[model samples]
Each structure stands twice: as C-alpha cells, then as structure tokens.
Target: MVEEQEKRRSSEDEIDLIELTRSIWAGRLFIAKVTSVFIIIGLIIAFTSPVEYEATCKLLPESQEAQMPSLGGLAGLAGLAGVDLSSMGGSSGVMTPQLYPEIVNSLPFILEVMNDTIYFERQDIHATSFNYFKNIVKPSVMGYILKYTIGLPGLIFSNKPEDIISTKDDLSFYRISKEDWRLIESFKERIILEIDSETGIVEVMVEMPDPYAAAQIAKKIELMVTGAVVEYKTGKSLKNLEFILEAHDESKRKYESVQYQLARSTDRNRNVNSATAQIELKKLEYEFNLAYEVYKGLSSQVEQAKIKLKEETPVFTVLEPVRIPGDKSKPKRAVILIVLMVMGCMIGTIILFCKFILVGKRGRSF
Candidate 1:
C-alpha cells in the first residue's frame, strides 16, 4: 500500500511539471514583448555610454643590492647575523616600493599631474589636464539626465563660495572649492596605481576618453613619480654634498695662504745661515705641508660625496612603456544585451506565475 501511494505522488509531480511548462509555452508572446522592450533599453544604454581608453605602464625600482653589487655579499652575511648593511657606503635612507602607491595617490602628486599639459587628439587642442576635464570634457546623456533630475537640488543650493582664497595668493595653504574637489575626485578615479611588494615593481594605469590623452597622462605620471622618489631618496645625500663642498673651499683657501707664507719665508732666509732663520723656515714649511694634507683630504671627500649622491638617486626601469590604446576599454554591448534579456525573461516568468496562482485560487473559491 505504501509503494502504491508513493507511485501516485510521483505521477502527480510529473503532471504538475508538465502543466507549468505548457503554461510558459502559451505565454511565450508576453515573454517576447518583455524581452524586446529590455533589448531596446539595452541598445540605448550601450550606445549612449561614453567610450574610454586605458593606457598602462610598468616600472621596476632599481634594488639597493643591484645598485651596489660589491656590497651584496656583505649585506647577505650581515642579514644572517641580524644586522642591516644595506644602509652602508653613504647610501641614504631606503624608500620602499610599497610607499610608491601612496606617493602616486597623494594630493600634491595628483595636482601636479592635473597641471601637466596633455594633447587631445580628437579635439586637436593642447590644454592642462585640469582645464580639459573641467571645460572640454562634456557630460554623457545619462549624466545630464541625472544632473537635472537627481542632482538639481545641489545645483540650485550650491555652497561654493565666490571669494575663495587662491593657492597663488596664499602659498602656505591650499584652499579648494566644491567644484575643484569634484574634479579632483574624478581625476583620482581616472588614475590607478598598483605595486608589487615582493618584486618592487609599480604599475600605473590611466583611463581617458581620448586615447592620446590617456597615453600622454600615463607617461607624465610615471615620470613625476620617478622624480618624487629620486628626490626623497637623495635628500640626505645632497645635503652631505653641500657641506663637503663648503669644507673643501675653506681648506683650499687656507692651503693657498700657507703656501704663500712658506715661499716668502724661504726667499727671505735664503742668504741667512742663522739658527733663528732656519728654525722659522722649518716652521713655515711644516705649516704649509699640514695645510696641503687637510686640503687634499677635503678634496677627496668632496668627490666621494658627489659620487654617493649619484648612487643614492633611484633609477626606474620601464618594464612596459605607455602606448596609445587601439581599442576601447569599456562599453561591452554584447554582454549588456545578454544581461538585460535574461532579466526580462525572469521578470516575465514571475508575472505569469503570480497571475496563474491568483486565477487558480479564484476558481477554487467559486
């Protein structure tokens, strides 16, 4: 009796599945209409979307070990002994690759990038990045729609002050307006920087509507970051060089004075055989030699300091150079269409099921 009841329940389940399938087949026309509407919407979105091009460049910071190969073996041994020898040989403090991303994202760095001149191929104009983004780049169709509808309040009641202090007038402080802050946010979105800590490699990516502009901005950012890094790493070394140069100049002057005194004393005492004259001549010669040695030592220190400054300055090797992208990076129309169509089908099925359930309940009530 149990087996017979189980068979009956299984048969009913199959019948229910068949009925649901037939219901869907009968309402195919309704589903098609929903899907068609979605497809049209998708087409509008895909077409109206702004195309963007991305340019990327990879940079590898020259390692401290690579810069000083002679010290590499010693450094390794010292590491085993729990001592760091990487800072030896007049090398300045290390600026790790991990800090590079922070450097690129910094406000000052972004402002520098914004002030750089970029050539827009489409517009056939050269302008500062700030001006191009603010004035030249126009809003998209949806952007305008949203601005008028959702963002209309902000426009009407904008709190932007008219008499804002300019950076040029107040060099010590930076005061930015609301619009400028929005522009800066947009710039942060366009510029992307990534770093690999293990390998100390940095990748900079910039996306812009214009391909040439994207490439140009990417290259400019790369150079700017390199310059910043070099400046940070060599700051101490430069100061050392300057101090050594001053000492070298002072020593040189003293050496010259002593040499002149020694020459005068020797010439005056040439005819005298007196002990006092001989003693005076010896003292002047000794003074001259002492001054000469000090001067020579400072001169060597000056050369060494200059060399150290050069060595401490970082070098960035471009693993992948920036190039104008041939194809757009966004607006995947096919994917968009497929997604919209699937959403439409799901919505149509839900509506049909709800209607069918309501009708069945009303029939049973009757």
Candidate 2:
C-alpha cells in the first residue's frame, strides 16, 4: 500500500511541473515584452555612463642584505695603537615589502602626490591634481542625480559655516576641509596599489576619464612611491653621514694646529741642548701623532658612512611600465544588457505563476 501511495504522489508532482511549464509557455509574449523594455533601459544606462580609462604598472623592489661591515681587523690594529674605533660601525634598518602599502596610504605621501602637476588631454591643459578634481572634473549624470537624492542628507549635515571656517583657519599641513576630504577620498578610489609578500613585486593601477591622464598619474605615483621609500630607508644613514662630516672637520683643524705647534717648537729649540727642552719636544711630537691618528680614523668613518647611505637606498625595477589604455575600462554594454534581460524574465515568470495560482483557486471555490 505504501509503494502504491508513493507512485501516485510522484505522478502528481510531475503533473504540477508540466502545468508550470505550460503556464510559462503561454505567457511567452508577455515575458518578451518585459525583456525588450529592460533591454532598452540597459542600452540607455550603458551609453550614458561616464567612460573611464585604466593604466597599470608593476615594480620589483631590489632586496638588500643588511650586513654591517667587518671592523674586527681595524679595531684590533687601533687597540694596539691605543685608539678606539668601535663607535664608527653601524647597521642600516631594513624596510620590508609590507610597509609599501602603508607608505602609499600615508596622508603626507598622498598629499604630495596630489600636489603633482599633470596634463589633461581632454581639456588640453595642465593642472595640479587638486585643482583638476575640484574645479575641472564635472560630475557624471548619474552622480549628479544620486548626489541630490540619496546623498542629500549628508550634504545638509556636513556644510556648516563653523566647520568650514575652523578648517580654513588651520594652516597645518594635514588640516583639510570637508570639500578637500571628499576630493581626497575620490582620488584615493582611483588609485590602487598592491604588494606581493613572497616576490616583493608591487602593482599600481590608476583610472581616469582620459587615457593620457590615467597613464601620467600612474607614472607620477610610481616615482613618488620610490622616492618616499628611498628617503625613509636612508634617513638614519644620512644623519650619521652629517655627524661624521662635522667631526671630521673639527679633527682636521686640531691636527693641523698641533702639527704647526710641533714644527715651531722644533725650529725654536734647534740651538738649545737642555734636558727640559728635549722633554718638551718629545711631548709636542706625541701630541701631534695622536691628533693625526684621530683625524685618520674619522676620515675613514666619513667614507664608510657615505658608502652605507648609498647601499641602504633601495632600487625599484619596473617590470611593466604604465601605458595609455586604448579601451574604456567601464560601461560594459553587452554584460549590462544580458543581466537586465535575465532579471526581466525572472520577474515576468513570477507574475505569470501568481496569476495561474489565483485562477486555479477560484475554480476550486466554484
């Protein structure tokens, strides 16, 4: 009896599926009209959207070994001569690949990048990034609509006179008004940077309304990032170099003065034959020798500090240089059309099913 009941239930299920299919087939014309309307709307959206061009570049950071120079031999020799040379040796700090993203996202670095001048091909003019974003670049049709509609509340709350006046008075480097912050946020969205941890490769992409502008910004950002990295890595070494240079100058002056004194004393005492004069000559000679050795050691340290600074400066090799993209990166019309059409079909099918169910319920009531 159970097997017979199961067979009957399966038959009823198959019948329902057939009825659903027949109902959909009968409503094919309605579905087609809905799809056609969606297609037209999709075409309008695709053509009216703002066009964007993308440019990308890849960089490989040169890895450096942070080994300090071996000063054991020199230290041993200096020790025998009763001079200390241990304070001159130092190791440079290493910057890892992970910090590249942080450096790029830093406020100061971003501000510097925005301050760069770039040429816009569409307008045939040169302008800084801040000016271009603020005054030159116009909003798209959809952007204007949404700004007044969904974003209207934010605009109302953010535009107080006190807020603007306070930000304007602050002349600090990091202080920015709401409008400037909006521009910065927009600019940040256009530029993307990523670093691969294992290979130490960096990829940067920039998107803009003009192809030339996109490529130009990409190249500029690449150079800025490299400069920032070099400056950070060599900061300590540069300071050390400066200090060594100052010490070196002072040591040379002292050594020269002592040598002069020794020379004058020898000339004055050439005719004297007293034990006191001889002892005084020996003391002056010893002072001059000690000054000469200190000067020599400082001179060596100056050279080493310069070499270390050069070594710490990192080199970035461009694997893929930025190029002007020939095609627009957005407004994929074909994809938009297909997705809209599929959505229309689903909506039409649901409507037809609802209608069929309501009619069947009325027939059962009768």
Candidate 3:
C-alpha cells in the first residue's frame, strides 16, 4: 500500500509540471510580441549610435629595482653574524608607477596635452587637441536625447553660451575656459589607464571617432607620460650636477689666483730675505693645495652625479605599441536586444502569475 501511494504522488507531481509547461506555452504570442518590440528598439539604437574607434597600447615600467637584492639585507645578515651593517642599503622615496596616472591627470600635464597638435586625416582638419575635443566631434543620437531629456535641468540652469566661449581678458593657463574644461573632462573619460598589480604592466587605451586620431593620441600620451616620469625621477640628480659644476668652476678660479700670487711673491724675493720668502712660499703652497683638493673633489662628484642620473632614470618598455582599431567599440546591439528581451519575459511572467492566482482564488471562494 505504501509503495502504491508513493508512485501515485510521483505521477501527480509530473501532471502538475506538465500543467505549468502548458500555461507558459499559452503566453508564447505575448512573449514574441514583447521581444519583437525590444528588437526594433535595439535596431534603432545600434544604427543611430556613434561609432567609436579604440586604440590600445601596453607598457612595462621599471620593476627591476624591486627584484634586485638590497645591500641593506646583506648588511642585516652581517649583523646577525656579529658585524654592523645597518647603513648598507638605503632606498629613496621616489614615486612609484601607481602614481603615474595621478601625475598625468595633474593640471599642468593636462594643459600640456591640450596644447598638442592633432591632425585628423578623414576630416582634413589640423588643430590643437583642445579644439579637436571642443568643436570637431558631434555627439551621438542618444547623447543628444539625454541632453534635452535627462540633462535638461542642468543645461537650463547652466551658464550662457557666450560666457563659455569668452576669452576677453581670461587667457590664463591656470584658469581654462568653460568649453575647454568640459573638453578636458570628456578627454579624461575617453582615456583608460590600467596597471596590473601582479605583472607591473600598464595598459593605456584611447577612444575617438576617428581611427587615426585614436592611435595618434594613444602614442602621444605614451611618450608624454614616460618623459614626465623620467624627468621626475632624474630631477634631483640634474640639480646636483649643476651644483657640482658651479662649485668646481669657483674652486678652479681660486686656485688660479693663488698660483699667480705665489709666483709674484717668489719672483720678488728670489735673492733677499730667505726666511720670509720660505714662510711666504709655504703659506701660498697650503692655499693652493686646499683649492686643488676642493677642485679635485668636485670633479669626482660630477662623475657621481652623471651616474646618479643614469641610475634614477625610469625604464618604460613598450610591450604592445598602439594600434588603430578597425571596428567600433560602442553601441553593442546584441547586448541591448538580449537585455530587453529578458526584461519583457519577466514582465509577462509576472502578469500571467497574478492572473492565474486571482482566477483560482475566485473559483475556490465560489
């Protein structure tokens, strides 16, 4: 009797599943209509969206410093064996690759970038990146729709067009024009800077309407960022070199003066006052020796400065150079259609569920 009851329960569950399947099938026409409407919307968006070309470049910055064993570690190990090595290895507080993006995004850097000349082949337009970003490119259909719809309030309350373009007396690099500021913001949005933690590799990406422009900008940024980093790294060394050069020059001049004075004194007392002449010669020789030492010391320091300049220089290895993208990077129509279809299915399911529940409740109440 128990086995028969279990079998009956299984059969009943199967019947319920079949009923559910049939109910879902009944809504097939509704689902198809909703899906078709979404597909049409996707088509409109896909065709109307602006085509953006992306340029990509990869970089490997100096990670060798971390890999090289420090002299400090060797010094510490010596201490463990009863020798003092506390002063062996000392590292400077140089900015790491992680802060590279921050440096690039700084005001001065952006201003420099704005001054760069960009030539667009398709448009035959030659202008500064500032103007290229500001006036040449047209907004996509969706971008336009959002401006009048979602962004309407901001536009309505914003500054006048004339004020944004005004350059009467406000030509300071620090205080950029309103239109230029907006362009900078947009330019920032289109640039991608990604650094991998494990590999210490940097990937830069640039996207623009024109393929040539995208690639050109990407290459330009790569060179600019590397140069900025190298300059930062070697700044102290360069200043030190300059100081050494000036000190050496001054020391040499003093040495020359002492030599001339010593010669004049020796010639004047060549045959008279032997004791006074000896004392005077000794004093002049001491002065000459001191100056000579300073000059020689500075000569060594200058060589050391050159070495420091080389050591502090940052190495940026280009693993993947910038390439012009052949295809559009935005307005993925397949994704749009799929998302809309899923949304429609969910709405349809909810409606059918509520209808069935209400009808069943009415039947039971009756």
Best by TM-score: 1
- Give the per-residue lDDT of model 3 (tens digit) for 156-267: 7755444432235656435455546767887788878888989989998898878888898899889988988878767777787898889888988998999899889878
- Please report, as a residue range, the 10-residue window in candidate 3 with the lowest summed lDDT: 82-91
User: What TM-score would you give candidate 3 relative to the actual structure?
Assistant: 0.76
Q: Residue-wise lDDT of candidate 1 within 122-209, one digit each (tens)?
A: 8999998898978888888877888899989878877786643356654646677777888898889998889886777799999998
Least accurate 10 contiguous residues by lDDT in model 1: 79-88
Stretches > 4 Å off in candidate 3? 1-20, 64-91, 160-183, 260-283, 342-351, 354-366
Local error of candidate 2 at residue 356 (angstroms): 4.3
- Residue 150, model 2: lDDT of 91
Please, what are the lDDT tens digits per residue for candidate 2 over residues 1-366?
A: 999999998997788779889989999999999888888888877887888999999999877642233445555655675544545444456677787778777777777778888888989999888888788888777778888999898888875333322323556435567777888888888888988878878999999888999999899889988888888888888998999999999999999999999999999999999999999999999999999999998987776676667666787899999999999998888999999999888888899999888987797799
Question: How close to the true structure is residue 337 of candidate 2, measured as C-alpha lDDT?
Answer: 90
Superposed by TM-score, candidate 1 places the C-alpha of residue 311 at a distance from the truth, in angstroms, of 3.7
| lDDT of residue 111 for candidate 1 | 84
Model 3: lDDT of residue 80: 55
Best by lDDT: 1
